[model samples]
Target: MISKSKVTAKLSVIDRFLPLWIFVAMGLGVALGRVYPAIGPALDAVKVGGVSLPIAIGLFWMMYPVLAKVRYGKLQSVSANGKLFGASLAFNWILGPILMFALAWLLLPDQPHYRTGLILIGLARCIAMVLIWNMLAKGSGEVAALLVALNSVFQILCYSVMGWFFITVVPTWLGAESTEFHVSMWEIAKSVLLFLGLPLVAGALTRVGFVRSRGEEWYEKKFLPKVGPAALLGLLYTIVLMFAMQGDKIVSLPFDVLRIALPLVLYFGIMFTSAFLLSKKLGFSYQETASLSFTAAGNNFELAIAVAIGLFGISSGEALAGVVGPLIEVPALLALVYLSLWLKDRLFPADVRANETAEPKDQATSLAQGGQLR
Candidate 1:
C-alpha cells in the first residue's frame, strides 16, 4: 500500500514546501519593493539585448536545470507512440489554450490585461515542471521526458504565433475589445529564443555531454542530484524579483490576485480531471494516465513570466498575472499528485499497478535521493 506520506516523502524538503516558499518569496519581494522605490528601475537599467540582465539570468537558471534532467537519449522511441503523441498534442496545444482563454474572459471580463496574461500562460504549455509532478506520482518518466522535449519544440515554433492569434485575432473575431498593446511575432520570437531556446539547447548539450563522458548511470545518479535543487532556487529568486518589480501593484491589488486565481484553479482542475478520465478510457496504463494528467495540468510559468515582463513591462498587470500563476499551480498540482496515486488504486487494474510499484528500487531511490522534484 502506497500511503500518502510514502508517496510525498520522495519529494525533497524544497518541493514539499514549495507553496510556502513561493509565498514567502512573494512577501519578501513585496517588502523589498516597498523598502526601495527605486529598486525596480535600478534592476531594469541593466539590459541584455532589451531584457533586464538579472531577470534573464533568473529565467535561464530556472529553466536550464529542469531541462537538463530530460532523458533525451530515449527520444528515438517517441516516433512509435502514435496515439499518445496525437492525444498529447491535441490536449496541450488545442484544448489547453482555448480553455484558458474562455475561463479568463468569462471570469475576468473587466480585466483585459490579466485575461491576456492567463491566455499567454495557456499558450506556453508545460515543458519544465511537469516532470516533477509526473515522477512523484510514479508516472512514466521516459514518456514525460519525451513529452517535455516535444512541447519544447512546439513552444519555440508555435508560442509566438499562438500568442498573436489569441491575443489579437481572437478578440477581433469575437468583436470584443482588444488591448492597445501590439506585440510583433518577431518580438515574441526573440523573447522565446532568449528565454526558452538558449536554455533548452544548453540543457540538452549538458545531458548529452555528461552522459557521454561519465556514462548515463553517473549522470543520472550523481550529476542530476547535485543540480536538481538549483531549479527551485532559481524559481524562488525569479519570483522575488518579479514581485519586487511590481510590489506596489501586488500589494495594493490583493483582490486582483484572488480574481486571477479563480480561472486558474478552474483551468487546472478541468484539465487534469478530463485528461485522466480520457487517458483511462483510452486504455493507457496508470503511468501514462498520470503522466498525461500532469502534463495537461501544468503550464510553463517561467516562460510566461519572462515574456510578460519583456513584452509588457515588469510591473504590468500581465506580469502580475504571470506571477500569480505558480501560486495557484503548486498547491493544485501537489494535490493532483496525491489524487493520481489515489486513482491508481481504485481505477487501474491490480496487474498494472503492481508493475509500476515493482520498478527497481535502485532507480527509484536514486531519483528520490537526487531530489529530482524540479
Candidate 2:
C-alpha cells in the first residue's frame, strides 16, 4: 500500500515539472506540425488485425500509467461517497451535455460538424488528466482512482447514448436531418474504442505488471514519476500532429477557434466553481474539495478528438474544435494547480505549515506505518 505522505511528496515533484514539460511538448508539437504534414495522416491510421494501428496509440500510452495505479476496490470507495459521486455525475452527464449542446448550437450555427464536435467534447469525462489535477490539489489518490474508473465506465455507456440523442433525436426535433445518425453512431463508437478502450486496457495491464514486479513501492517511487513527463510529452506530440493535420483548417477560420473555445472556457469555469463551492458546503477537506472541483472541470479530449475525426473527418471543423479543447485546457489546468497550492496556504494555513514542518517526518511516519501510503 502507498502512504499518503509519499503520495503527496511525489506529487509535489510532479507539480514542479509538469508545466515546463507540457510547454516543451506544445512547442515541439508546433514544430512537428510545420515539418511533417504527411506524417500526420500516417499517424492517424487505425488497425485492428494486422493493419495500421490508429494514432490514438499515443493517447493510450499517455493514460496507461494512471490507469495502472487504479485499484479495483476503489470503485466501491466512490460508490460509498454517494453525494460526491452524484454531484460529479450530474455535472458530467446532465449539466455538461446541456451546456455543450447550447454552446454548440449558438456558436457554430453554420458548422453542424463542429457543433457535434462540441457535443462530443462535453460528453466525454476526464479520466487520466483528472488524476494529475486531483494529485495537484492534494486529493486522495484512492478517490481520484475511483473517479477515473467510474468516469470511464460512464463515458463508455453515456457517450453512445448521448451522442445518438444529439445526432438523431435532438436534431430531428429541431427540424434537422437525422439521416446521418446511424453512420455517426458507428463512427463514434469506433473512435471511442480506438482512443479510449485501447489505452485503458494497456494502462491497466501496465499497472498490473508494475505492481507485480516492482512491489508497489518501487512502482510508486520510480514508475509513477516517469508517467507525468511522458504524459506531458505525449500531449505535446499529439497536439503538434493535430496542428499539422488541421493547420489549414485553423488558418482558414482563425476566429472560429475563439468561438469554439467559448463553451469550453465557460464549462470549466462553471464546473470548477460549482465543485469547489459544493465541496466546501459539504465540509470536505481542502484536498478532497480540490479533487472534486478539478475532476468535474477537466475534459477528456482524446476521446472527443477521435470521435470528431471519425464523425466529421480529420479536416472538419468538429475536429478543430476538439483540438482546441486541450490548447485551452492545458494552460487552464496549470493555473488551477497553482491556485490549489495557493488555496492550501490560505484556507489550510496550519495544515500547510504543518506539512512543511513535517516534511522530514513524513518519511519517518511512512516507515513507522509499515510502508502503507494510501
Candidate 3:
C-alpha cells in the first residue's frame, strides 16, 4: 500500500497555499485588465459557441490531470457506497438546483441575470478541485475520485437539462419572466463534450494505456505523482485568464461581489450543513461523510464558467456570476476542509474511522480492477 503519511509528507509549497495562489491569480488578472483595457475585448472575440478557445486550452489542461487520476474503474464500486453516492446524487442533482432556484428567487428576485447566474452555478458540479479539497481534509481520495468521475459524467448528461428546466421552464412554470435565451441542449452538449467529455475519455485512455505499458505500480507511484499537480496549475492559469477577461466587470461592481456572494454564501453554508447532517444520520464514517459532503457542496465552477459564457455572453451577468463562483468556492471549501477534520474527530470517533477505511479501497478495486493504492 502507498503510505498515506508518505503522500502527505510530500506536500509541496504550491499545495500548502492553494487558496493564496487562487486569490493572487485573481488579483493579477484584475491588475492586468486595468492596465490593459483592450486585452479583454480582444480575447472575448475568440469563441466557438460561447466557449473561449484560449480559456478552453487552459481548462483542458486543468481538467485532464484530475480525470486522468480518477479510477474510472471505481465507477463499479460506486454501488458499494450506495448510501453516500445516493445522498450525493440527490444533493448535487435534485436538491441542489431546487435550492439554488429558491435561494436565487428569494435573494435576487429583481436581479434576473444574477438569478440566472446562480442557477447556472447550481447546475454545474465540481469534479476536479474537490479532489484537492478531499485530500486536504484527510478525506477518502478513492471515494473522492470515484465521485469526481461519476459527477463529471453526470454533469455532461444533466447540466443542460437542469439548466433549461430551472432557468426557463421553472420560472415560466411559476409565472415569472423567462430570462433564458435559446440555450439548446445541443449547444450545452457540445460545450460539455469539448470541455469535459474529451478530457474524461483521454484521461481514461491515458490511464489504461500507461498502466498496461508501465505496470499499475508505476502508473500510481511514478506517473500520477508527476502529473497530478498539473491539474492545479491548469486551474490557476484558467483563473488568471478568466479574471483577466472579466476583471473590469468585476471591479466596476464595487458591492457586486457582496451582492453576488450573498446567495452563494447561503447556498454553500446550507448545502454543507444539510450534507453533513444527512451523512451523520445515514451512519456514514468520517471519510465517507467527508467525501459525500464535499462532493455535494463543491460546484464544478470550471464547467459552470464555460457553460455560462457559452449560454450567456461573456459580459452577461450569468457569466460574471460563474466567475465569482471560484472566488467564493476556493476559500469556503478550504475552511470546510478544516471544519470536516474537526468534525471527523469529534463526531466520527476512532472506531468509525477504522471501520470505514476499507470502503474506498473496495470501491476503487471494482472501478479500476486495481486502482490507485491508498
lDDT of 3 by residue, 1-374 (tens): 33455533445656655668878988998888889998788877787546567787886887777677766676666559777878888998988888988998998888888888888888888765676667656566667767766786677677767777888887888899886645555765566577666777898899999988998899877787778777768878877887887788878986877788888888888888789888898887776788888888888776677777767777888888888887788778877877886777688777445644755443222111221223
| TM-score of each model, in listed order | 0.80, 0.77, 0.82
lDDT of 1 by residue, 1-374 (tens): 44446645776677767768878987898899899978888887887645568978987887777678767766677557788888889899999999999999999999989999999899878866676677667787667867766776777678877888899888999998765444455654565567667877898999999988999899877888888777778878977886676687766788999999999999999999999999989988887788888998899886787788877877788988997887688668877887887788689977445754775353224233333232
Q: For model 2, what is the alpha-carbon lDDT of residue 188?
A: 42
Q: List the residue pairs that clash in candidate 3.
A: 73-367, 73-368, 74-367, 125-300, 126-300
Clashing residue pairs in candidate 1 are: none
Expressed as tens digits, the lDDT of each residue in 4-70 for candidate 2 is 5555564443343556766666666655665666655665554532112443555555555555555
Residue 233's lDDT within candidate 1 is: 83
Best-fitting candidate, scored by lDDT:
1
